[model samples]
Target: MFVRTVYATGDPAELGTAIRALNSEGRDLLEERPGYRGAGVFVDRNLGKLLTVSWWESEQARHNSDEVMRERRTALLAPFAGTLAVENYEVAVFHVLPRPTAHGGLHLIRLEFEPADADQLADAFHATVVPRLEALPGLARAALFLDRERGHGLAGTLFTDHHSLAASRAAQAAARQAGAAKVQMAVVGLEEFEVVHADAHAG
Candidate 1:
């Protein structure tokens, strides 16, 4: 699977309005596109940042939506956005813990690491990271996406709520470090986000 993410920063109030507009205008349109799978919006009200991600079956499908997405973004977010960035990645692993109970309000973590030794990284994720994540308190789901040839990786993790996420910070930090080292990779970026709008079909 392939993924595209739009990162934006703006006023909380304007962001709320912009997001609603996106839902009605562009979000729904994605589902009608070829190879569309799912999408989700992640925001941080206090930080005034939002990250929207959409899933596609292939790079071509993702690229096909670029023009329309660009137009929509320019029309809707131009006034509200302070900064904007877009990125694409290949999904290496997508795992949802069975029977997740805790619900409502999600604490999301996005970690990017170097992708050296792709095979080793993938192996370590399944053997080490997966189990640790599944055992984490209040974890809902986690996915690791990588560009094997480019030496880039994106790890997205969702927690049940703020407290649950904060409580696991220590352990998560340790695991992140160990995992990166195991694959001879360096941590490039790590950020926290709030899941603002999620739907049944969202990835």
Candidate 2:
């Protein structure tokens, strides 16, 4: 699968309204596009930031839906009246205990890293990171999106609630350090997000 994520930093006052608009209007529009598989959003009310990620079956499907997505973005973000940035990535590893829902107490960590051996890195993720996360408290899902050749990647992890998220931090950090060694990556950016909406298929 391929994923496209749009990120925005808006006024906190208007950000909530915009995010709710996405859960309704924006989500419906995304569902209509070709190859649309799953859609999610992260709202950081305190910081006034929102990130929306939509999944597609292929890179071509992702590209084809740009026009409609652009229109939807303009209308939904109009109230906030600011610019947003979009990024595309290829899904490498997607592991979950169960499907996720809109109410998921999502805490996401987006890590930007330099790439090395793509295959070896993928193996390291499954062998190391996946197992560790699978055993974490209240974790719902974990996914990785990458442009291996370009040496950039993003990872998202959803936890059940604040306590689960907080308790797992130290373990996640340690695991990340170990995984980083095997993945041969240079960390660039790492940020936390609150999941405002998440819809995952269970079949």
Clashing pairs in 2: none
Task: Show model 1 residue runs off by greater than 4 Å.
Answer: 98-116, 199-203
Q: Write the per-residue lDDT of candidate 2 for residues 64-107, one digit (tens) a residue.
A: 99877886786787676366888888888888776444555555
The TM-score measured for candidate 2 stands at 0.91
State the lDDT of candidate 1 residue by residue for 1-203, as single tens digits.
88888888988778778778677776777877888887777777787888888888889998998767777776766566899988888877777755332332344445444545777777887777878877887787777777766777777777777777778778778777768667677666677776655432335
TM-score attained by model 1: 0.86
| Structural similarity to truth (TM-score) of each candidate | 0.86, 0.91
Would you give me the overall lDDT of model 1?
0.73
Q: Which candidate is the best by lDDT?
A: 2
